[model samples]
Target: MDGSQGRKTRQVVAAIAAGGKVGRQKDLLACGHSEWSLRQAVKAGMIMRIAPGYYALPDADPLDLHLARHQARKTCFSKAAELGLWILNPVPQPHVAAAHGRPVPGCKVHRVKGGQTLMDILRQCVGCGSELEALAVLESAVVLKQCTVHELRTAFSRRGDGAARAVIAMIDPQSQSIVETAARYLLKKVGYNVQGQASVWGVGHLDLLVEGILGVELDGEKYHNTPEGWAEDLRRDNLLVINGVWKLRIPAAVVLYNPDLMLLWVERALDRIETASPR
Candidate 1:
């Protein structure tokens, strides 16, 4: 390529690195990459042409590629999960904010915040997700220090009572994981006195303690996969039992996928613990 073309290509690359997306006529022109230079970069495999006017880096995230190709911005459930915030349900489709007519299938569509602000994305999440789901995202965000409880409360105040109020009232920044957050939500929703990250004398920290009687463990797959971890978990459970803390270990999958069944098991365990208690 010529020196001029090289300079333009460098400009294009900088733009992509800054915004993760490059638009042909718009961004290329703004970034000093002419149509020919854009073509040269594409031909040289320096960048990928996603849609008619959009370009992505060769190694861009597939989801972002899809977003650029579809001319949409990720928001709500999609953004929350992508940001590593806790959410109760798995996103069935990427939630996107787009111009009124542009809709991506297998993704929820919102007409608000087509190119969103951080607050706009979070507020949209509060509006889009269910009460429990919203709470999970908010709690995770606060715990991760991405957003503060005061910021969330302010955002909720702007939106008025309903989902935001519901979420803010129950948000727990101390909850460890999405699974742990979901378990707490479930137990709370069912009117159980659930305390998260409760310390037990012999077993370290229980995932949750319900009514100060039943100990609950929410085991993630990664932690329980190895033999050493499995044995350690067994040892912990045995110690808890020996200490007379009636406990139930629930898998993360059951917590995420089959919360009702998990709850039923908890209720049954509680019943057994209650009955077995000295009168």
Candidate 2:
């Protein structure tokens, strides 16, 4: 191929990869690539024929390849994870959506077609996972600005979606991470009115505020492992103490793994705070 032909072929390959790094034969043809060109490109190792009608870049993602081979789209927790959403409990196998309940080996398939929208994935998540899991995914979407809470609520307004709609109502966009979301949910479930991303006079924004008094800081290791992070946190703790605000700094793992213990600690703190209050 000459320089011009090579550039055109590269453009074609880029177009194919743009659509999830895979394209159908008809899609390639639609992009103005002739059959001969496709054959030449395949032979030249630019793209690979993964399935009979599916073509993909030579180094496409394995999940995308699997989805193309099965004629399916990722759904449920799998799709949420793909979209960089928070998942409380990730499943072992891939979760997918296919038309007419077609079975894909080693995958948990949802009976649906064209699972391309975020709403479809959220609905599948609600159907396949627990309520808490659904809430985490929805909040993640909100935090990422992928979709708005109103849009999600509107999508789930149809019949038989009361549960899903309720979960959507619980979404707090200010909950920065999955750990914060889980901790807030647990506190709320136990009848604590938790405010997310609450600001203090001297300490800026906290991860959560319980009953407008106790400031809860959910510490993920990624943010607090560095020396600078440790110094900043200590400074914030000193400020909170000086400001007469009761505070709790709970690690992300403690909230995820031993939530009951976390709740016990909070209860004890609150008890002490109440006892020492000036009447």
In order, what lDDT does every prediction score? 0.80, 0.88
Candidate 1 Cα errors over 4 Å, as ranges: 1-11, 14-43, 49-53, 59-66, 104-107, 159-161
Candidate that would win on TM-score: 2
Per residue, candidate 2 scores C-alpha lDDT tens digits across 184-245 of 99999999999999988778998999988898999988989999999999999999999999
* Candidate 2 worst ten-residue window by lDDT: 108-117
Compose the digit string of candidate 1's lDDT tens values, residues 28-111.
676566888778788888888888888878888877877777777678888777678776777788888777646676677787
Measured with C-alpha atoms, the lDDT of residue 19 in candidate 2 is 78
Cα lDDT over the full model 1: 0.80
Off by over 4 Å in 2: 26-36
User: How far in Å is the alpha carbon of 93 misplaced in model 2?
Assistant: 1.0
